[model samples]
Target: MERSLSFRSVSILSPESANGRNVVALGVADAFARHGSTTIFRPSAASKDPFTRILLDAAESAIPLDDSIGVSPEVFRSHEMSMRADIVARYHHIIDARTLDSTVIVGTDKSPITDPEEFSLNAKIAADLQSPVFLAVCTLHRNPDELLATVHACEEAVDEAGSKVLGLFVTGCSPERREDTLNGLHELPYQVWTVPPQTVDPQSEDSIRQSLESFRQQVPADELIQASEEDWNIPVTPLQFQYSLLHQAKAHHKTIVLPEGEEDRIIQAADFLLARDIVDLIIVGERESILERGDALGLTQLHKASFQSPHDEELLAQMTTELCRLRSKKGMPEEQARKTLQDASYFGTMLVVLGKADGLVSGSINSTANTVRPALQAIKTKPGSSLVSGAFLMCFDTHVALFADCAINPNPNAQCLAEIAIQSAQTAQSFGIEPRIGMLSYSTLGSGKGPDVELVEEATKLLREQAPELQVVGPIQFDAAWSPQVAASKAQGDPVAGRVNVFVFPDLSAGNIAYKAVQRSSGALAVGPVLQGLNKPVNDLSRGAMVQDIINTVALTAAQAD
Candidate 1:
């Protein structure tokens, strides 16, 4: 039981409707600081987005400058990624340099919710930083649905911009509407907390105290970060998992087969893996082409292992017969099976099937469907597995988050979703993660309804019935699933509410979009679509994957073989 996703900075965004914007912003930051996080206060005017400050900074006087100086919007945006990364990395450095528990809380001018586009300065900054926003809205004069609508707007905007809505903070409401607003906001999938309106000066001790007290009373403290350090803890960050997986793979001296052995990246990875002695490798390709290419590329070390060609007479005949027998119900003919076995995907997979190699790794030069098809037809599914799914190991500075079904299952039924959840949990554990699974949806604990919500709700029930010993909770929003404060507000007493390490997305659309958003926006390292439910380990690769990505995938494939 390890906690997940600790960050160096947290930014809070207030909706346009929030009263006393500065007061609300500072109030939220104060609470984080009190909870052992060193809060760095960055005002929205100071953001890297020039237009953001220009459009919204009322307090700062604009300097009159000559019109000659200009940077084109296209040019500015092209450099936006690097600039945003530098800003976030700078904050991480400052936070790490200090011994204290620290975080940087920057204030945005208004909710990007009402902003015309999702790529606005505030939104882009949040997306680039992968910061979780605490959307502040006033509930005093608004209808419950009105507040809920605004919150949803913010949610869409942040999500589109590549960030997450951590929770909602409501201020200046009578107790009656307050309850209604809180309940209504919960209908959507985010946490709802309250902040007392600062009628007096925001800088005053009383105002600060009241803000801190309100947040403390409304949101339960997250104790994970405050817990004492221990020696037996599993590695928590996904980037860290690369090293950990490589280390684990080397311990047993496993063998992994590479189907795309002739690809430059595969050659480089094979050379590297061999040089490091992380695992034994059986590279499947035309022996002459591999030798010629390896010699040309100075990757002669690949000759260390006998080149495994799919066309080898004995191996081809064995694979064809086995494949035909495996697919006998489909009445696959010997000629058709023999032709299929000629494919490197099939040949490489059969290496694992025949126990010649521990696992298979491909797709560096193939489509996911192409790489996975052979495994599904040959190695087949594991015992108790209904269908195969995918998970991306998102590595951040403080922790690693597992995002599931991101690459498969477009829209699964309850049983399929449940199976994916269980498979994802097992996958996480194989990588040394103690899986506290979160079944994510737009609704939390029956607060809302629809076919989608019901699917997740039903899937959660199925998972509980299937694996009662697992720490699984669902029909929970992303915010409530990961943030301690938000979990307290919306899903108190649920074990998996705030401590989830495995996030099971409802559909491929949500999972794919979310994992990509977090990766691009937050600059986190994502390690897989670590194909789950296969009886033997066979991983597909992204065509554009880097050399290190290939190495990591190979290591993971070997680890999965265990």
Candidate 2:
């Protein structure tokens, strides 16, 4: 059986006072509204408080706050059960007035820190409303075990109160203890998220929007949503695009191994990654040296990342044995495998191969070959792919495009070219870009002829024979592929002539020069050389990659992980 939505409504409640619950409510409501119509209702208060006005200003409310039948916070405190019944009645009244794809029910606010009696009140109200419940807890100043205990208590208490606990949101856990909190939560059987402390005050409309944006940037994209096909064409700044990449990584938490952890930029990137809880991380380096460098830079979150020396006695021995066993057909000896395990790139790649990590990001200080070789030896190309290729995601203000073979495969044959195009389209799809490929050449539909143009034309034929469902326009010049007027004059009446997002160059020289020129001259944010067709994601960074570049690459690597 197939279900479209796992739940039609969610009740965001708290067993106690959680500071960011309002912001969480807005973000979750906005997420559901993006795909379909969603209503926001708060029934515990008839007075239009700041949060209620914030919801109204955000255009998420089902009705006016004062119009809904709600109990006073004082009255609720005095008569908990009776007010809980009134709150449920108010929710039904508001929801019955409107038709919505989803509804977000904001439960009563806990005004006091020691409001012990209200622990199951929110849960019981949600149960009466027939909605699943999300528990938001203020985890400030709490250790990991203590935080986990609170979550378990909430789960059991909610269950006893006759409501299903949907998810857990922890706010304000210290960076020192966040890693442990997340690790412990991962052992549980449900979804748990560590949210950044809300920054903007929720009193005003502008601040409310800011708060929603903050939550959108930090947490997973619709963590409770199981499916959506909505497209938000909203334009974003470069910084926002980077945040989108981070958001994609956080949507599914993956563990990425960094082989160039000794580099300062890599260490700095790790700090950012771990601080944001974007992914679980493992850094292959001398733990002491890395932590010392991080401390010197005033980095607070590096301690949260798991660190491993390439030559750790137990790990090195285990990896060496595994490597020799994997390569015994090539007559690999124990001594040779052990020596290979000492190299950071090889060790990190082996971690991925042995299922200790999901993906590997390296080449910050090493050459591209040093990073790609080990992955090729152990991970190999993805099934059904003939060869590996790379694509640089060039992001503009409004949209992002793919510039391919930019940093891999110097001179691809026709077959290599076809595979590159196919793999790149798949890569674009995976990264949430709709692939409209333009096989770029010096010619526009044979307006100018050369061996290069002929090669692209042949590759286009092969691509059509293989993945005919792909949108492709080949043997086309850049002008025709990009500009509508130029396309009209050159390849008239062709659907894909001017609306292409994936650019496939004839060779590495064209791709490398083009992406760099666009990056430096046009000031586009170039985000890859994201290697595609790997069995597991292994991304290579430029030796001169900046801190921000490494951060984006690591996020992309995590997004690509299995």
Best-fitting candidate, measured by lDDT? 2
Candidate 2 per-residue C-alpha lDDT over 440-544 given as tens digits, one digit per residue, 9 for 90 to 100? 998988888778888999999999999999999998999899888999999999999988989999999999999999899988889988998899999999888
Q: Residue 249 of candidate 2: its Cα lDDT?
A: 89
Model 1 lDDT-worst window of ten: 61-70
Candidates in order have lDDT scores of 0.70, 0.78
Q: Clash number for every model?
A: 2, 0
Candidate 1 is scored at a TM of: 0.60
Writing each residue's lDDT as its tens digit, candidate 1 over 357-449 gives 999889998899988888888888998887989899888744677999998689999999999988988888877678999999988787789
- Prediction 2 global C-alpha lDDT: 0.78
Location of the lowest summed lDDT over 10 successive residues in candidate 2 = 227-236
**TM, every model:** 0.60, 0.62
Each candidate's root-mean-square deviation in Å?
Answer: 13.8, 19.1
Give stretches of model 2 more than 4 Å off: 1-237
